[model samples]
Target: MSILKKHPERDPGTAEAVGGEELLVTGGHTFKTLTDKVSGIVEQKPPAQWWLIFVMAVSGMLLLVGVIGWLAWEGTGIWGLNNPVGWGWAIVNFVFWVGIGHAGTLISAILFLLRQQWRTAINRFAEAMTIFAVITALVFPGIHVGRIWLAYYMFPIPNQMLIWPNFRSPLLWDIFAVGTYFTVSTLFWYVGLIPDLATLRDRATNVRKKVLGFFALGWRGGNRQWQHYEKAYLMLAGLATPLVLSVHSVVATDFATSLVPGWHTTIFPPYFVAGAVFSGFGMVMTLALIARKIYGLEDIITVNHLEKMNKIILVTGSMVGYAYMTEFFIAWYSQNEFEVFAFVNRAFGPYAWAYWIMFLCNVITPQIFWFKKLRRSIPVMFVASIFVNIGMWFERFVITVTSLSRDYLPSSWDYFSPSIWDILTFVGSFGLFFTFFLLFLRFLPMVALSEVKGVLPEADPHFYHQKEGDTK
Candidate 1:
């Protein structure tokens, strides 16, 4: 019988039972359903709906290629870099994409440590988003240097000239931080994927089985195999939890260590970290809803799961707002002329429109989640999540452009406007990120099948009596 029909007296919209015991794997999912639903995405042929999205993603990617080609031919001069505004859209884009990448690690690591069961539904999807977003973010700093060919010079190597990158630079710290983040995140994601891959291996035919078997690492599902796997996964989770904080803190250093008025704030580390989580969760919610609809995994990725995610979004969005207010408060409290001017200029200056947009979207928008009805409404949540994403991108732009466009010297001050190439490059990054995401959706198990199964009621060894209806 359907869980819904079985509990006819239960709340119509809820997946829970009469006694209010929450359902984890809903839709009357047996172990077979859990395995089949997840692995089936990979084993089945591509759907017509999936191909439509794939074509669109590829078109965007092609635009990215064309933009990069033009950028390479004409050089950085084609961008909007000028006397005072050197960072322009490149740094803005870099920070925006980096911020979007943070939620995955946070969900996968921190929530796991807290034993949040809801995370199992979304962590795989979020982790994949992180890797793709980081890849898109990496493209900016390399090309922003104007000499893409000399990008290798950022690394420490024994060249004949022996010119090492500036060891003291915060940008150098960014390289270490982001590099380590990507590396550890990949390891963590892959480790989590192994058991799911083993599930795929067991269920597959000849060719598919062989391919998945290789990556499955010869798992026999023995007690020893699980013992080792659990230990390794726990260790990776521990290592990654700290990285979720450290990576963005280092990115903030790229601006905070600078002497620029708005950029030199001491609160940037925590501020950037909060903003990162806020933006990252926004992207996750956006994609999670779409994935839920398209894949018909509504029962597995339930409304309650989404509600929990929105709560996190609300908290982090508020943290970001606190950072914004604190920035203004410190500016006034410090009694520093340039600092005061910077905050004043950000609100009422040339880029005031963007600042207000950021404020409204980041601050005023997410406040809707305060109501339970709005939190459960998918349509409302979808619009709100997109607003948060847009707001975050603007936040980066407002910080990077407004701060640099009007610096200490009035003579060198000029407005920053992105040229055609700059605009296209930024748009192209969305193509790069979504193309990988679409392909991942088509090919991989979107949910962690093994993890989901592990959480099912039957998986408990001590639950044999419950199944037998013995209340001893």
Candidate 2:
């Protein structure tokens, strides 16, 4: 088998599955058929749908480019941002997309560490989401600075004043956090592509495909090469796991470090992480649903996969809900009137609608997962995912707005609304996200062709047993 010949460590670090005598390999070395499966992809392409994705992606790109052009020409005066409501959708969108990026990492890294094989099927596309979402996210903060050219200041550079980025500042932390995440995630995705590229290398018939595929780094199924590759992958995976925690922790510090009552809280770090995974899963669900339908990847994507993700949503949803309750309790128990009023006004005051909507969507809607049937149903899952996305968006909205609205000075209090640009740009962000993702779907393997094959029963099911029954 070429897989074992090319890759080393069949079932990399796989232990014997329960009641089974075989050791399963996960790193593609064990799955010789991986390349064959991946190469078979284009054969399954629906010409009509592929064209549709192309058209939508092009349209989205136009919206993103057009919006940026308009914003650049008109200046920051075009936004709804004001004195107390200084941070508007731009920041909210930044945090929102960044938070959405977390699901990919969790699925790829955390789930892998826990040996959840189901993750393999969706990890590729989800990682793509992480990349594009981060890209869209990066745009907001860079532009939020008003002078787009000065965005370089976020990074420390050699200058006449010898100005260096401040490590103590949360904003500076964001630059490093986001940069590291993007770089590491990209490396992880590409490195995992080697053998698959080789598969393409072997299967490609045209001069262009052969040349491009070969340059994907001449990879023959060499055991030694696989050993080194597996080591690097594991090492990177280990490194990436902590980066996931730290990056979002740093993002939360942006608000928590501030003196504002609603913003100032130690729970922010974990809260943000939970919300990030929550929203990210919602996004993955959104994409996976469409991808499965259009690409006809049902057998690989599976209903069980959706259910597993739903269970995670339920868990994270509860964690986020607990965060809300804990935050309120702490605010009241702290005996601080500013914090007390901030929490009170958010609930029973002018923004009560947002608060209730957030509660109902986040806290109430996820309860549908209690029924196993609903969790696995595609339509139900889609609806629940939409609810989570709305809830998570409102989660950011509530945090940013409630904190900034009624500050210590009552006279400075004001309710903010999004401008036309703000609303369109927000909508256009989805276009940007989908645009990048749709391209990945068409040009690249939407599924981790090699990785998934490695986890298939033929490769060494003994290695990737996510449950005891899989031991067989």
Candidate 3:
């Protein structure tokens, strides 16, 4: 017999039988137990720890709201943008949060298509993370336009102005790409939650049942409901697959379409997509670790799951590093003076410290995953993930700020710095992000309860048939 036998469990989304009874979900649970265990979280009184996290998150959100109101009132003067450096921390944060949103789609859509069973345990939470990250990302662009009221002009409105947005510009492509991605992703997430919501409704108190049932869409576990649910889920997964690639690609075009020395590279689309997955995975790791500890979800979100995500981080990090090298190689090979200056300036210019930090965090830190022992270590993985997040943010900083600060015009070049409002607004987005995340954890089922139940051996009829010695 092989050291690892085929896992007797069956998962609805996974076609292949995985080996090793290493247990994707711990605690021997029947379907009833699984539903109760997950839903009981919402039914129970809030933990002291939960309140502490919620308070901090809400405070940050209040700060974000206050800052946005002030930004609207005071106008763009509160930021550090100037003549040459029109693009500053706002653009950087926008791209940073957008990149951080990619991992959830990758796990929820791409992994599902690939038939990865482990995804069932954490896909719900990951999807929530994606939605919140995108929400944070949308703010920067809205505020960056200076006239917050006029921000709606980016969309095609049948108004008397009759002046449509410049469709030819890649920047405009962002509105379509991100808007579509968010819409589809939200639909996918809500669809997945229906069955679980039904489970919650069945196990809830009278008032709570009404709330859960409203969202549950009258789910009754009938054969027809499961059939339709499966079809809808697969369709959404197929629809979302391309978005994991397209959304960030459109974002990259915003820079690539520009003729700026550092920004004009053709590699931006694929490179940005890779970096997005890298940074998004980093955010997932950061949240997964904290949530697991707080909710005692170590069984559902196992060390193996963490290791798998770490591997993706390492792969995507290497891809980003290669993009960095390719940029330099292209610069040197082309022998273009301005391009060379931009590349060299990025490494050794006034912003060299930021560039080096990006290199260390996005490249060097993730290399720690090459060691299996450290990859599986919670503390090591958590710290490395944090570094990746910081590094990826600085990666955007280096790309956006460094390039614009010292452009082709020698006289107009100037260093970009953030104002107090800029700093506060950026920090406040975190509050908005976590405030939603905490509420999600508190109210919604953090794990996909139905999907997880499907992963158990008892769920597989064939496994029981084999036990009865019935070959057919």
Please name the candidate that would achieve the greatest lDDT relative to the true structure: 3
Compose the digit string of candidate 2's lDDT tens values, residues 1-472.
1233333343433444444533233333334444444456653564587678767767766887787788888788788888899998898999999999999998888887887888888998898899999998998988888778777888888876688888899999899999999999989888876776666667666884777576678787688988998889788889889999898899999999999998899999999999899999998998899888876577678788888899999999989999999999999999999999999999988888999999988889888899988998999999989999999999899899888988999999999888998887887888888778876776666777767766655455443343333423
RMSD of each: 4.3, 5.4, 4.2
lDDT of 3 at 317: 99
Instruction: Single out the weakest 10-residue window by summed lDDT for candidate 2.
Output: 21-30
Pairs clashing within candidate 1: none
lDDT scores of the candidates, listed in order:
0.88, 0.82, 0.90
lDDT of 1 by residue, 1-472 (tens): 2233332222223222322457777887877778888888878887787888788878888998888777777788999899888888999999999999999999999999999978999999899999999999999998888777888888888898978889899899889899889899989999989888888888888988899999999888898988988999899999999987999999999999999999998899999999999999999999999889988889889999999999999999999998899999999999999999999999999999999999999999989999999999999999999999999999999999999999898898898888988888887889889999988887678898888877766565434434334453
Candidate 1, which segments miss by more than 4 Å at Cα? 1-21, 469-472
TM-score of 2: 0.89
**Higher-scoring candidate on lDDT, 1 or 2:** 1
Residue 87 miss distance in model 3 (angstroms): 0.7
Q: At residue 152, give the lDDT of candidate 1.
A: 85
Which residue window of length 10 is worst by lDDT in model 1? Answer: 1-10
Question: What shift in Å separates residue 184 of candidate 3 from its native position after superposition?
Answer: 0.6
- TM-score-wise, the better of 1 and 2 is 1
